[model samples]
Target chain A: MIWLPLVGLAIGFQIYWLPGLSLPSSVAAYLSLATLAGLDSIFGGIRAGIEGKFHDDIFFSGFVVNTLLAAALAYLGDQIGVDLFLAAVVALGGRIFLNLSLIRRYLLTETRLRWRREG
Target chain B: MSTIASPPSRGKGWVFQVTALCIVLGMLLALSLRTQRRAVSEGIPNRWPALRAEFINLKQQNASLQKDLAEYKERYEELLRKQATGQAATLGLESVLQEAKMLAGQIAVHGPGIIVTLHDSPKRDVNETRPEVIENYIVHDYDIRAVVNELFAAGAEAISVNGQRLIATSSIRCVGPVILVNSVQVAAPYVIKAIGKPDVLQKALELPGGAADGLFLLDMIEVKQQPDITVPAYSGSMRFYWAKPLPQPKEKSR
Candidate 1:
């Protein structure tokens, strides 16, 4: 869903407000918020794909990639003295570049529903 | 999520992803806020208690300084006023007191000398501005005691407070709320007569704000010396409890 980036932004803001919060507690709070956002996104993504709507592989790829990248950057920032915001930006930027090229339109149109509609 | 001839790879359910994300983010927010608060409530210095005590001592010293400074200002202003009015111009009395202290110290000291008297000032009228000044007025015996100590510190050969001859085993003790030197109780207006380098002893007495903070409790307290002073035989025992050194921290073998 379009909410992927929104969710990412929301999570960023949450952690930004409380930098020194230990990992376990952040995991707990984000888990609940992410659960609600994730469920809504999954349903929206599935519906759009079935309707031959805009393939959300790009969005899903971006979100997943960005999430992992963000976590890694945060860890790196902890290890080094890099600014957290800059680290987050590097993560988000890296994910956007990897997703657009890797997530293919051919892969999307070859789906089962698309085959049913054409063949 | 895209149309796929086969199907998408087995993706973790939204529930799992959501659960992971929510749990992680919450804990971090709380901790950052806590650490920020800790820094501000305590300043940069960790050894604050001693620093604060020193600060208090300094503030007390400052207050005494301010009192002296104010007196100096008033006297200076009075002199200024006199100079402006064309009255006989001269240096301030504080300087004169300082000079007297220096002169007294210079002229009175070592071996033997005279004993001068320092009595309480004339009692103030009830209508006086500050009542505490009069109510607490007294040549607190420590005034003499402090002078005695200063004389000792200044290498006085012999000393006495208020005409009482000091002996080898003598003590200046506060007994029954009345201070006693050589077992004789002396009241306000005590005189400190010493025999030593008079100049050094007097300079020692007037070395700045007179010893009232930890010594005498009165207004306009001072140390005056006799014209002729001499040192007598002096021997005394001094004792103090000494503390041993503390052990340092060490690491354990793992």
Candidate 2:
């Protein structure tokens, strides 16, 4: 779950560096986002593989979340006067929060359990 | 299978799991990066707003360069098309401009073109208009075309829609009444620039059957040509577009 937030931050890093100014560039930006999203999926796939279950299934969830975020961003941009940049921040920011929650609920909870087992 | 497994081996298994996860994460990060780079090079700057704006600028510059490129391509094609047309090894930008200077006509003039600001009627909403259809508030493609055509006919050699110069392959398309010049959206008051026999071009526009006739239909219109003349360089990228092309007839394979 925290993967989502991490993705957002990474996108933020991209915006801070390479900003686009034209229609085609908007497409380029999307391509970049998709690339990063793909990477995240790959990582997820590898993680799943090690888990001995359907390894690549994690990417499916990532795809759903990213697509929703992309669609929401388009709609929200039109609703408010927010440009793509600001809207991305919002999406990424939301992702970060969700990721943090995932880390807490899953990873951190697991750690706590492991400590109890050891104790 | 684990009945004979040592405690140290179990611990090592945990370490291996963590390491695998780390490697997977690293691979994912690398893949994400590859995607972003490829996207930029391929002309799909679809990331966020900040980069989006920069890409737009690059695209605009690219269009100018593209226009010049098209001019070269046209001249080259013309040479190839004409058996009678003599061949020139480099019919490039520099030589073309140089030739133009050498053949510069005595009547040619330099000046700034008119910028017409046609505001949407106070009651009409531009945002409300369907970009897919024509509407009254926005400027129509035909109007701009008429303006450009009249300018050229009047002897204007160089022209630009908004700040974007019109090269040979430049296209002006209408989405509703909104006209896109060089695939960049522009709104009124439209600033059209031209370099030509200034007096003749102006007189042609002001002629009885010119852009004037269409003004009454417009909520606002203005036209003029002044002498503080300059043509800015195209600053956008001219990337190759493979798709979005019209279907060409394919030959049947034997």
Candidate 3:
């Protein structure tokens, strides 16, 4: 968990601080969908961690597979002249919202239980 | 969070891997955003007004710079005349100056050469038949490059299209309906002026299987040779940041 925030910062610096380094416009759609999928996985992982159900294998594999599948779907769509990345975006976005709601509920219950014990 | 039954050491490893994956995700997000921003900013829709303003600014700067260069060149020539002792040295200096002027497009060139004019065909009505052929009616960037290439191969010393002098770095492109030469927008009828031996330039363009012949077969084009023609000096910057002259090998003393 500690390494997570540090790694995030390093990646941020690598992107925003580097000059004359840019991805091609054609690949933006694919990268965007992959990013969305990655976001969903990270949130899901956090929720699972908080609930004491986080599995090392599942979390790591899910992260890699989700991103790769999203990007692959986008590329396939490009080759076929269809907007398939939008499908990936919708699926990942729905999952992210669902994960957020669960996270919220767990936090609320945990806080209530702790307060009751203190009282 | 730590209350799970899994071993603490194994849990830490998972956390590290997941975190590393998150970092990769973050980098991808940043790159996607930057690429999108660049695409928008560099796209034709957003750059038109900005480029127009920049073109005007550069034109003004070019004029002022040319004036300053002429003044300095005159001063330098005067100094050279006063310092030189021999006629041979003076003649050599004059020849070098002429060579430099030609290469830099600094001096207005006048010689017997050819003038080639290209005109885009008049647009047709909405219901015209053979609609696919309409694309062939208009002049393209490649057509201009072809003609320019032929003129240079025919030994044209200087050339200009619609008053924009052609230089090594000059780019001719088509943006929508108009042609852009050295970043200046020009519309048809396009007039190309080349300074060389009149007969040779004319013959090169009139070659049976040449760029000019191809244009004539497809569209309306006019080629004329004159006794004298003038091509204006190049008005753009010639500064090169990346290209460098190769170092010469030192010769062993005999």
Q: Backbone clashes in each candidate structure, one number apiece?
A: 54, 44, 0
User: lDDT, candidate 2, residue B218?
Assistant: 51
Candidate 2 deviates by what RMSD?
A: 38.8
Stretches off by above 4 angstroms in model 2 are A1-119, B1-134, B216-219, B236-254
lDDT of each: 0.50, 0.55, 0.78
lDDT of 2 by residue, B1-254 (tens): 22222222221233333333334344434444555565667665444555557778898999999999999999988877773433333455557687564333212334555433444445455457575443555567777787788787877766777777666567788876477987888887677877766667767776766664555455445556666565444445555687477787995951
lDDT of 3 by residue, B64-176 (tens): 99999999999999888877756767888899899988887877888899899988755434565685777677788888888999999999989999999988788899888
Model 3 residue B36 CA deviation in Å = 99
Chain A of model 1 scored by TM-score: 0.33
Error of 1 at B211 (Å): 2.1
**Global Cα lDDT for candidate 2:** 0.55
Model-by-model DockQ, in order: 0.06, 0.04, 0.15
Cα-based lDDT at residue B135, candidate 3? 69
Clashing pairs in 3: none
DockQ of 2: 0.04
* Model 3 complex DockQ against the native: 0.15
Cα distance off (Å), candidate 2, residue A92 = 99
Candidate 3 off by > 4 Å: A1-119, B1-90, B122-131, B249-254
Highest TM-score against the true fold, candidate: 3
